[model samples]
Target: MNDVKPRPAGLRAVPSAVWALGFVSLLMDVSSEIIHALLPIYLVSGLGASMLTVGLIEGIAEATASITKVFSGALSDWMGKRKWLAVLGYGLAACTKPIFPLAGSVGWLVAARFIDRIGKGIRGAPRDALIADVTPPHLRGASFGLRQSLDTVGAFLGPALAVALMWLTVDNFRAVFWVAVIPAFLAVAVLVFAVAEPARAEPTRKARWPLSVAELKRLGPAYWQIVAIGFVFSLARFSEAFLILRAQAVGLTPMLVPLVLVLMNAAYALSAYPAGALSDRFDRLTVLKTGFALLVAADLVLAFTNGIEGVIAGVALWGLHMGFTQGLLAALVADAAPTELRGTAFGMFNLLTGVALLVASVLAGDLWERIGSRGTFLAGAALTVVALAALAATKAAGPGDGGSAEAASTKEP
Candidate 1:
């Protein structure tokens, strides 16, 4: 008889800290999505920006966050601390919330966006590392999945709220933006009050200059492999703003533009946990492969279909792919990196991938401008094929590969 019985299944098994952090993410996402859902149209129609400029801005904002993550993550390692850094990051972001409603020009909006992302950069790695710190190895996938699912819930909820507010305000973007600020602050409050850092068994040892070559070398080849694959995946995916632009191109009204994200996020939120839990049980790489294939399917759908219904189908697929891929990648990083260097590993991974996203978004904008939305999405499909090929080639290289889930866990959970 097996006297040890089993741990609680699903969410009950995850630590309280992970749940609190997920709520923090959910609140912040709700705040951010409300603004983001409307921002592309606001920049184009209200502030007189062009498609290339929109792409440039979005790319730069994300890149800034990724770049900042490197320093912030390294700092967290050097200090042997995670929670306070996360708190500071969330606070900074919350402070930037009001600026969106107050901005009168593109420059103001850009400045606000840049600062806001810096805050995200500051928090992103530390928070992720914290999740790894608290979660048991056996439950890593489920923990990440639950957090992602909750965060995505806010992702859709925010846009749904934005659509409702848009109807009520008669399409006042500023009013909707003002409303977004509340959740940003609430997210900060939750992080500060509800989440607590886990106690380590050993005394905290600081990594001297965590960004140094020696320190990076400690992250090992497995981590680097994940980073490379992540970069390729980013190139194939690009920014979500393009989805809104595509909807608009196909005659979606400004008032209903946010519905695009609402639909996409609904798919993402629904699938993220199930996909993650499934990965924990089966092979993660295989699930990720299916996700890559889904992206390919999504891009092809968007490329060929001219009707709104087709665009809707493509966007939903896009969301589903996100669900299957994003959290799994994070869990892989936690699986690959040294516990002490998890922050730097996540930061470096994000840095490379964020650069790829910049390149992809700018290229997508240029293609859309020159050849239309169809050409842009067709190009995306082509890139996804290349990424999928790269992934398959890696798997073909044999067992003990950097991304092999089986390699990481030799025993049953």
Candidate 2:
């Protein structure tokens, strides 16, 4: 048998494309966050939208992003291009931001969100694939962590900026939406000018359009197991919108909500890279399992607590969970995929997660409506426990272990 060598670490040498992508993420997040924080208010207060409408809008937006991820990723693979697709996706999202200021009705707002999510769907998979392409295997976790950290930093800053702008404008949601356009434009400009796509190796003559299921099946059982876990994990995790609603229920003032969001993002930013680097050294699944355990604890805490203190603690735990899992999940996807089909792999992984979130959020919304907020949270906690149990059972099984990391590491990518 030929000895398989572990890949060397090359992520310490940050590339120009990574920095550009980070800046793009920072700007884009700033734009998106500013709009996202105030959107519900705009719908409910300004347009008199019902809770159902708000739920539908959000669910649709997320579903759109999820559904398109795989197709877009696969399209990028088919075309052997990543940058232009990323540009298109970012551009689409940037263009849609301005429409929010123009929206006079709930319908218009929904349309704008749909358009923006479509852009997200288009650009997301390719952008991730590009990140995988530039980063070496050994540094993959840290690379993704750094990207996620910067992304979360932008997430932190965006709402803070929105809060400041809202205060300045005396709560003029439209003006805040208008201000978001500037950053959106800047993000697109950075992608177009600063980021360069790496040259790809020549594809075999056998490469075909619309990748085959057999090609996808070539991804071993371990990768599929991770995807299954991701889906379950996502089911337990509902939208952050619910968290904001919970904050409101607990008497947190609207302005204060953004600050709490900043805190959560700060925790995410702090933990993302370190946790990711740890995953590089240790088992990714083990790291992800820790995150799942933390989430269960967070859900239980949130379910029982009644004050801002509890909300803060819960949010912080949520951030910690996000930090540990998000980048590590991406690294696992990258690790499990064949390099040539990485875009496709990431797309499918995201699609499954997206579908999972859609179902989870709907279930959460229904649970909230029927059983109350406490019920919704308790349900999430139960699901998290179930996922953890699944992980434990998988771990106890052993090498031939079906989807063992050793097996995952030996795969194409």
Candidate 3:
């Protein structure tokens, strides 16, 4: 027998639905990153806030999304519909964009950020579930990778655009924010008209009481294991604001700070598709471990080094870690959950991770305040070690699981 194996189908073979979703994500990220790349500086430099305030705001905003995802994911499962909820989420986010440019006080910014994150919460789980639904199992990794890559393209573009616009407007932050609104609405429009819900999995049970104990129990041990892995992983990751702060600390000007995100996201976009495709063919857990190693390496580099070269290398490593793990985690949830419970599973996982992230960011800020920047990253490195240990012995990292192309559509039966 010939030992050579054929490669799987390429991006052209991916569904139109997946591509549409990717664009939706791409547009929304473009809108979100443009603001996010500048939001921390705006809050601190312009609004006279502190790093702790930035961390608190970021944590709370993200935690709110995690809280809402629990309900939104359940709701999507109950309705057996993902697209409409995602549309509503995107629409809600679009409506919040104008507020960023108009806010005069911290309270206004906080309110807008809260609502915007709520929109993210609403769509996050359902959207992930929808991707799993539409694509065959064999293509789930590639599908997710493509979506992440597109989303990351937007991520980089938003910051790169912000850099250009900030210079044009003479560092007019509000103008850049106003421009961000256009892409957000475009995201909503694409989602509304272009994306369609796939057929629901066969009705295995009555739709009532999706959150009931019986239904919750159906989420399975494997899914919970993945959730645990995600939670610990969150502890290792914090707000991107710290990356910008690190860049600024090393003497990068405000107008050029967005370039940090541009660099980070560029690495992310370039790596995500290849990583996702690799996960589809290789052991996802092994790939996840590799991502963990990269994250640890990033933290160590940032912790021990200084200046532009260090920041660039560290941020690029951070992006690489994201490309390696994020989609794999999504695919893990898809593979582990029962088809009917995917939305719920993703929501629950995010909820845990969200809470962990909040705590981690707050801790990071505190560490930065009391000790120094090095302390913050060193702490992150410590947490990454813990997370790596958790994954090595846990149910999440099974032997050669979800490694083959045949495993893409292989949900928990």
For every model in order, what is the number of clashing pairs?
A: 0, 1, 2
Q: How high is each candidate's TM-score?
A: 0.94, 0.91, 0.94
Residue 300 of model 1: what lDDT? 92
Task: Give the candidate number with the greatest lDDT.
Answer: 3
Model 2, position 196: C-alpha lDDT score: 90
* TM-score (C-alpha, index-matched) for candidate 1: 0.94
What TM-score would candidate 2 get against the native? Answer: 0.91
Candidates' C-alpha lDDT: 0.86, 0.81, 0.87
The candidate, 1 or 2, that scores higher on lDDT is: 1
Whichever of 1 and 2 has more TM-score, that candidate is 1
lDDT of each residue in 1-413, candidate 1, tens digit only = 77997756587888999899999999999999999999999999999999998999899899889998988888887787999999999999999999999999999999999999999999999989898888766677788888999999999999999999999999999999999999999999999889888886463334668898877877766677778888888988888999999999899999898999999999998988888888777777788889899999999999888889999999999999999999988888887876677789889998888889889889989998999888888888888888777777653211113234323322212
Ten residues in sequence with the least summed lDDT for candidate 1: 396-405
Q: lDDT per residue, candidate 2, 126-148, as tens digits?
A: 99989888876667778888889
Clashes counted in candidate 1 amount to 0
- The model with the greater lDDT, 2 or 3, is 3
All candidates in order of lDDT, best leading: 3, 1, 2
Against the true structure, candidate 2 has what lDDT? 0.81
Candidate 3, which segments miss by more than 4 Å at Cα?
1-8, 396-413
Error of 3 at 339 (Å): 0.7
